[model samples]
Target chain A: MKSRNLPLNKRGFNFEMIMWIFTRLSALAMYTLLLIGFIGALLMGAREQMNFADVMRWAFMPNPSHVINTNIPDIAPWTALFWQLVASALLLVATAHGVHGLVVIADDYIVTSNGRKIVRLISMLMMASTSLIGLYILWTF
Target chain B: MGITRNVGLMTALRYKGQGPMLTFVLHRLGGMGMAVFIAIHMLSSFLGGKGGQFVNAIYEHWSFQLVIFFFVLFHAINGLRITIIDLLPKLLEYQREAIWVEWLVFIPVYGFAVFVIVSTALGSGG
Candidate 1:
């Protein structure tokens, strides 16, 4: 009796399965994070009476006008530190999900075993280095 | 099925087929593009933080920033759409509809970003 072969993506609670699950969950998290960042930015801009154009201009070229003029208290140092930590966490999750997603994509298109291996290796290296660099930058801030 | 799976430059341009299938391809492409941008972003942030000339040179290019923004926006929006369809299994029955809804949401949000980015860039004499 011959047995059927399972697809590489579905290996029954194996590495691929875990990575697949991580990608989905991370994507959901990323959606929330990205939304928060965008909304927060827009709100900040609005409070400063800056339109989207002004906000974007400020992004490209920071000026005194971009500074918060509201009577609201300034954010504490710890709050800034907390946000940096959040950003770092986002970086790690996004990189892992994106790298694995790309590898799986490469797997779908790349027929040869060697080609897939090469792609996965390169992706892993890139993911690791980028995450490290991003974390380093975040901590410095 | 008739679409040949050949390896070539053109292979990258060809879609596997229409609608949902195309969406899947685009999502993956967007993911890859975002991943690349994130990597570059890490390096750029590091350099820019140190006031490196390389970072300023790259940041000066509006086109690069535009592409990055577009890719990330698409990925985030489409990703949410995908999450919705996955979490609500019943929505699978309306996969086609879901995809259409995804695009409907995507276009306006993306268009707004483009308008802001382009208008600002051009207005700033970039």
Candidate 2:
């Protein structure tokens, strides 16, 4: 069989390709964070202290406020800086992954190049604001 | 460049592309649905008062739980299947089988989650 190699520039290094890879990695990252949160909650006695929905809320964000209303005696472990960082990372990753997805879907209906650019720009702005708001709540609350 | 025409919702729904098409459409819808839910959740948490609680109340409803869980579970599983196929091109030939497998995995897990959600709601008199 004959083999041909493409030029270096033709390789998949474009913005879209990077985002494609990012979406996959972010999904994996989220699963990891959720697992860590779930295990940590169980270690904290979530099986007895929290209901399924509350445990899910805690696992999804790992912020102390999410579990304050629960029967957990002490919130100190969950209030640790590590979980805050985890929540922050989740916020950023999920926001970027989701907004990029919206942009990709928008491209299907938006045929014009300019329209795509505008949509991308707006998506970026939305992602940024959402992340900022989420991080603020995660860190301060 | 090829000309593009607007696709009406009814027209798009009437198309008969079958299984793959249904999965593709559901995947897009699921992704969008989750994104919207995330936005609402973040904003509500940020509001942090009666206003926030008001928004939270809506999603806390059992019906909302069913819809959101469906989106999250389906999108996550279908996404994993797509990623596996993408990484291992040999699996591309098994796309239909992959989707069938996806549904096989999806139905039971989703059904169990739904059962739990409903039972919890009813148990709590929701």
Candidate 3:
């Protein structure tokens, strides 16, 4: 009897391997964002460095406090556009990949594609909403 | 769950060895460890005004050697695991033994963290 061997493919030979890569990459990206953000916070000093209020000084203003209705605190704009923006963007990318990786785990467990689809939808929605919230928070700072 | 089992078809395949499952599991546990710390980081970021008290609390309790020891171990082990899976593909063969060794090290690490947290918490007049 003869046996067949599989051929190699790039973009990873299988989904699990791909998910593995995604987790590692996402972790690394998160680590980078964290380190940068921490460094930024420490450099700014006591009251002025952190807090939604300090960052809000630069990130948001409604022209008047009473207008739009919601009591959103003004967040400060980041001191530097370069690393901070890069870090925030990287976080978004990591969040996207993280959701995708988790979806793969879900797909591995859920037998039905319909269930998988629903899960993916919910996952994406939550991720998108969080991403937006994070962005809004960053922007307000 | 069934989809995950028997699907050992690891890509970038090199060598295979029967290794202790504990080490591999511990490596994953590192992820949970980092996650706990990350949660603290986020929450602490929001704790903005209490910089001094916050720093003091951390130092007076979870910031000591035992805690740091476990934290560093988990981070190092997980980081090692990530490096192995992502970068050094050849190491998967001996991964079992490597993982077990990690667990052996983890024994002391865990002991230290537990001791630190307990002692510190107790010392805090809790």
In terms of lDDT, the poorest run of 10 residues in model 3 chain B is B11-20
The per-residue C-alpha lDDT of model 3 at residue B33 equals 49
Q: Tens digits of per-residue lDDT for model 2 on A92-124?
A: 888888999999898887878788879988997
Question: In model 3, what is the error at residue A26, expressed in angstroms?
Answer: 2.8
Q: Please count the clashing residue pairs in each candidate, in the order shown.
A: 0, 0, 10
Q: What docking class should model 3 receive? A: incorrect
Order of quality (DockQ): 2, 1, 3
For all candidates in order, the CA lDDT equals: 0.65, 0.85, 0.51
lDDT of 1 by residue, A1-141 (tens): 244477765657787767766777898776566555545555544445554533443332122222243222453322355456556667788778877887877777686868877998899798888888877776764
What are the per-residue Cα lDDT tens digits for candidate 1 across B40-123? 655776666555547645744667767766676667777777777776666678888888888898788667867876876788
Off by over 4 Å in 3: A1-20, A33-90, B1-20, B23-76, B100-126
Give the TM-score between model 1's chain B and the true chain B. 0.77
Question: iRMS values in order, in angstroms?
Answer: 6.7, 3.0, 8.8
The reply for model 1, stretches above 4 Å from the true place, is A1-11, A39-46, A49-79, B1-16, B47-52
Error of 1 at A36 (Å): 3.5
Provide TM-scores for the models. 0.74, 0.88, 0.49
What DockQ score does model 1 reach against the true complex? 0.46
